[model samples]
Target: MSKIAQELASASTNTEDFYADLKPFANFEQLTNFDRYLPLPDDWFIGVADVVQSTRAIEIGRYKAVNTVAAAVLVAITNALPRLGFPYVFGGDGATVALPGKYLDDVRYELARTAAWAEDSLGLVLRVTIVPVSEIRAAGHDVRVARYAASENVSYAMFTGGGVAWAETQLKKGEFAIHRAPLDAKPNLSGLYCGFGPIPTEQGVILSIIALPLEDQASYRALVADVLTLIEFSSRRSGHPLPEGGPLPSWLGGEIQRLLSRDSPHANLLTAAADALRAIKTRIVLAAGIRIGRFEPSKYRREMWQNTDFRKFDDGLKMTVDCSPEIAEAIEARLIFAERSGVCLAGTHRQKSAHLTCYVPSNIQSDHVHFVDGADGGYAAAAAKKRRVRLPRGTNGHYRANRSIDAGERPHRD
Candidate 1:
């Protein structure tokens, strides 16, 4: 085995704190620095959950439902393994997580139950699967991960080495697929919420982008750095989709969806009434900027903006940013030029506003994380648009014509 692979194998023997042991880098721009990522242990496993026909659902204005169901996968798993810190990414319509083999069965059960609940309650078919890191390596790819500390309490995972992309492709082809649990099965989805309405862009539009390298790793890294530099040059906070004060709760934002996700016998009128009251209370707190017993509204809002996964890396670069018409056009032009030069393949979509899906363990804590996407159609649409184009040859002499690059479909926030 290679030296790094051997080290990873050794680390697998004591896997409990593998993720926690790695030092985290605070800057998102350093994502292109290959040395920051470490190979996952050979014994680790990757779990993938995807929503089938998500594009169709988005077309019918069910984007919020789709985003909620996608985020639910991670929330369920996290609640199940509260003491363990794992790496996960949330796609607009799906999610991917990696954990030690010791927790494999537990995670599998949660994922199966989550799939069952999504279909039964929301009418969304969630495909779930688990693949070993060894199996991925055997297929000629590796899963290397990095930690981006978005806040003091939250650090998002950035995946490279292409193993995640390979796993998603296999899952879609019915390989290593996990059967859904019984219809009545339920996963702990305690903190999942889609309470905020779409944020209208102060910038001209919301742009969703997905870009992949068509050449060597070095070239791809340079391309990513260039793209980030362009964004920073436009405005240091141009990529932040939320406003300075954070998002406001909508009357019909996601209360019904949250209520329906529960399978408890007590999920009746009284339960819904209680949830509605909580929502009203939250609105009042945010509107008045009040502080109530350890939960400071202003401080929470600042953390929410900082904690959002607006731009992330999962095998490739995926971002949802709010920018003006001129900035968006400039980005698109740069991507097109890079594509023509055989450096990368990219796709972008534009909308008037951006959406937010949140997982708040507690309003009093700054550890909560938010997921961002274009309100109408986000990464799924951008990926679909990308597949329509003919791809170029890589520096390694491989033609990507028949290869599917949409495998890494989610946001990268643990």
Candidate 2:
């Protein structure tokens, strides 16, 4: 074999044995350079969310609580973005998310809806505004900004309370009289408190929202659902979920805390921030998903693949995915009555979490997979990763057919 071919073969053999060890790239300057290097998707969808009147929370003797809630909201929004097929940024007081160009309308509706809902649910007013990229630059702000990549999260909600609502309603209703006409005198809110500027997205949509009143709650939810439905329909027509990253779980704060404590001297600084951030309602709602692997040594993990039957698929058979041994065992308990073999294997270490693969043999048909966890609902197989496939119960063929045939569909059933 050619040297290149041999090298490729050698690298392929070690793929499963490799996992990226990421440290908190917290240097703002380094992050800025990284942002420039990050090949952003063309025609992104962007939205800015920021808190309204967070100062009031501080004045009301809930300053610490407010900060915690703010961080939580940001985490929640950040977590949900991956699920919705968007890359997001967590500004200290707000967030910016970018969706694919094709998913523009869907993103617009869903983001707006989510922002509104987060406002009500978290008891914090989050204002979301959207604008095009042209507007972003026209306003003299660099829209491409970065927070702590892989480590930090962001959140915001709509405005509440009668006084704030009244003021916001008047603003929307053109109550602010100006020298220029209503359209001509649009307020330029750049770098305001808890305010987000314009955002550019992969989906031709650039959205920027400042403090907007949470007036007409029903209308906002309807708009959100409508946008989501549109996105779903588009996804069905295109047969994909506008591919992006995955949702993160909020509990990841704890994981981050542990990792920092174990590896870094400045763990205290980061941990304090993580603790305060996790207390926020938004982070709780939009946390990232991270699963712990069973406490097997690295050597044992390397050999785990040898025991599994990755190629065999029995008729009516399927695979169950779990985060840890306990989860896998619980799932196994549910499948006690199945007449086929059950194979459980350790998942690769990614980020801070581990995955488990379970081969379920059964007589069921239609080639579908089920996820029992609400947090990880509609889970799908990951890319560039080999997953075990359980074929129909009786056919018993090698599962080599699991090669990806479509953009979104992978070996795992959703």
Candidate 3:
């Protein structure tokens, strides 16, 4: 057999490990480089969980709740495969994770469970879909991925090749609706938190924005860079919009302390006592700046600052920006220019407080990571706006299928 044939055979086998071992890209400076991407194996699958009609949900002021339910899928799946190292990216309204066929059934089961949990506990509708790499390829695309280390503890997944993008469209178009099945497991969400509110900037307001590429536009990345500048937000700040170590706000600590518990405040005596003790201890160490094993607040903050998932590109640019009202106006002006230039479409929301969602390894010191989004209506709102704007048509008939996104479909249900 030819060497290329042999390589293709190997690629079909060690799917996840292949990309996991590829050198991780370092910063936004190299965002446009295509060689960094490694092809996903045909034996793997990509799972997406997005809140249906999230724009409407955000309008009703349930953005924080929406963020949690969307991130809940990641927390659940990681816990299920604690020892495995896979790639996942957090979106304000949902999440995307990829793994090999070996874990397909387990991951799907988790998706079902997460979907049900979102609807039942959170009163939000979640549409989940799992598409095989073969299916992605059959649709004339490949799932390529690269790992980007945002910091010492946070390494995010970056995807390209238009495969995952196609899968998302297929999902929205109802192509994969038959794959959804009944789910019965309860998600393990111990580390998720909405306790902290938005960080106020006398600047004006905090904006959650999502920007998608304009078909045939010169460079979406450059357009996003301009948008960030107008907002006076340095792409340098980490993707986490909130600083949880408590230098900014203190009074909110009491409410946050209560929300940290896993059990109800009205639970029986013993449970309540234990919950209270744990909450207090967590607050003291985190707030008082105590150093425990790997719980150094200062170092973690630095890492978060350097390695946030904001200003990231995975077919589009989605970020949480803290902008003053003046800066917001400037941003609008720039966006209008870009829109007239037929360059990009953006959705933005200004609100108070930021939401934090976490994926805790059974061993917290290992590979735990947290995701953050704007409080009321983060990138979800931004994405909603982007959705309404028509996708630009490529000069060559466009890479996207002809159909518009089926915004009303529930792709996760069988």
Candidate 4:
């Protein structure tokens, strides 16, 4: 199959050939290395929960017991998500979840209820960040999971006897939302960090989520089942729920429409966007790609192509989207076509523009967007499945000497 594809890539200049050309230079190999990274969908709503004082648990000689308790909480929470029609990840000190647009409110409410339960029963503190899926999707990057491992050890050493325990985090990003949860938050154990930008894939969107233990694991898992149920129900709904015939739900369509009728400015923008999206088919693709896991805004983009944010990457084109779920879905569908053609998509940059900006490379065909070597510019032919040119002509200023890097050096990306 690869041989046939490669031959076609070398033989033609059609869109298929474009993919073929991109194939050889494509970064599909990066997906296999996801143990160090993760590929999360954008546009889905998500829930995040964390443990309160994991470090104290270790100090109190409850490390072993707390770990078990934490695991149990995660199990229950994960279980609860599915039941609630949502899907979730059991982060070490916390958990992250995803929900369809229809179930967004239900899931968020349930998570709040569950958080209260966890705090009371498990003696943990739970904080919630209800973010736009677009925010999280923008911060995807590959970090050596090993990097966290090293940091964990260093944190433990600093605390003396009851060193920080190993923990994991869960993250979900999309055109409309981003959700994150961490296992621990102990000062020395782990640092809860996040970023928003593009990931290497068909999507070209990214978001980051991380957590460090702060309290006992017992508190972490307190509301496991409830959270899991919520997610499950939402997932099921995403697949099976019937659309409303005329009247929309109170949470989204109905309210938004009502506001628009009243002539609110934001409502008008949303209405216009919604109409434009439906009237025209936007190319939305889903790609599996790599990410740079850990990031610090201050040190972002110190190196030209080596910047922490996608904005500083060498790529000439970029698009950072902050949209509603409906809008995100439209974009994702278009990308799916690109993915089949083997487009190398990635999560790049923390959000530089308040709204998602689609970068247009000077060399990119008007009809097609080529995702390629950013730091060291290159052209990609997805159907050709190879990276053809090393550096394309007319790269953007940001595409030049690391100068295009983020000026604020502080990112609210994830």
Q: Write the per-residue lDDT of candidate 1 for residues 1-414, one digit (tens) a residue.
A: 775666676674677677998899998888878678888888889999889888889999988888988998999999999888899998888999999898999999999999998888788899999999989878667788889998787899988776777787778888999999997787888887788877888878789998776655566677788778777778438578889778888864465444553358767777776767777878888878899998889898888988999998876789998888898898898888877887777788999889898898888878899999889888887766424322222112112553444433332211
Each prediction's TM-score against the native?
Answer: 0.92, 0.29, 0.80, 0.26
Q: Clashing pairs in model 1?
A: 90-411, 91-410, 91-411
Per-residue C-alpha lDDT of model 2 across residues 334-368, encoded as one tens digit per residue: 33312132222112111112212211111121111
Candidate 4 segments exceeding 4 Å error: 1-41, 64-87, 137-414
Query: By TM-score, how accurate is candidate 4?
Result: 0.26
Angstrom error of the Cα, residue 15, model 3: value is 1.9
Worst lDDT 10-window in candidate 3:
390-399
Candidate 1 lDDT (Cα, whole model)? 0.80
| Backbone atom clashes (below 3 Å) for every candidate | 3, 55, 9, 138
Write one digit per residue (lDDT tens) for candidate 4, span 170-216: 21122222222232211111111111121232222221111111122
Q: Which of candidates 2 and 3 reaches a greater lDDT?
A: 3
- Quantify all predictions' global Cα lDDT against the true fold: 0.80, 0.27, 0.61, 0.25
Error of 4 at 203 (Å): 43
lDDT of 2: 0.27
